[model samples]
Target: MGHVILVTGGARSGKSSHAEARVAALPGERVYIATARPEDDEMRARIAHHIARRGPGWLTLEEPFDLAGALDRTDGRGPRLVDCLTLWLANLMFADRDWSPEADLLIAALARQNSPVVLVSNEVGMGIVPENALARAFRDAQGWLNQRVAAMANEVEFVVAGLPLRLK
Candidate 1:
């Protein structure tokens, strides 16, 4: 099994940067499994910014869904960085696709990986309760997903103010 690291934090907390560095430290070509979709101008700009920050030496794969399949395909190639799970979850939810089965598949794939994987996820449960039902539901689902991944991860880090605090 590969070394699985989960990097989580609030928005703008530098989770993606830290996760990228973790994957960059490993040997072989760096694979970036980007989950974000360029749905609008703002999102496209954000994606561009990430691409610019990463600079080069990355084989980027845009997989808004089927993350498990992406991992399986990239497994033996190199260290992969899944840049943010929150957007993946949102994509599933907004598209009316059942996310539990996909998440389960991801966990199974992670267990069988042969190369290192660094995953970025947002810590959304730290703030006050959301007002809308959909927002609350998303929060609950994100918390559950984070817990499950962290439990299976070999190492977990919570980033705050660009600092990664090891949790496991």
Candidate 2:
């Protein structure tokens, strides 16, 4: 059986950095599945920073909305680091696709894979509910996604101020 590790926290909480460090420690090639889209200059710069941090040795796969497809492509080789599931959820939500099915499929696939997976996500539920409908829906969907991933994950860690707290 494989190991599923979920690293979650709020914005700039170092969840992605923590996930990268954990995956880098593992043996074999590191596959980074980045979900963030470079919709603007700021986002592009953010993506570049993450890429630079991961260095040039890691293989990067940009799957903005097809996480299950990306997981299947991993082929159980090495540790797969999925940087931020929240963006994937947002992409799906924006596309008008209900994200539950995809989330379930991805979790099930992760559970059965032979390679270790380090999934990063945001802990958005700690904040007050959003007044806008879309934002609220996104928050709810993200919460559900986090719960599903956490349930299947062998280890769950929450990062705060660059510190990791294991929850499972």
Which residue pairs show collisions in model 1? Answer: none
Task: Write candidate 1's Cα lDDT for 1-168 as tens digits.
Answer: 999999999999988888988888899989999999998999999999999999989999999999999999998999999988999999999998888888999999999999999999998987889898989999999999999999999999999999999999
Off by over 4 Å in 1: none
| lDDT value, residue 101 of candidate 2 | 89
User: Model 1 — TM-score against the truth?
Assistant: 0.98
State TM-scores per candidate: 0.98, 0.97
lDDT accuracy of residue 134 in candidate 1 = 89
Query: Where does the lowest 10-residue lDDT sum fall in candidate 1?
Result: 123-132
Computed on alpha carbons, the lDDT of every model, listed in order, comes to: 0.94, 0.89
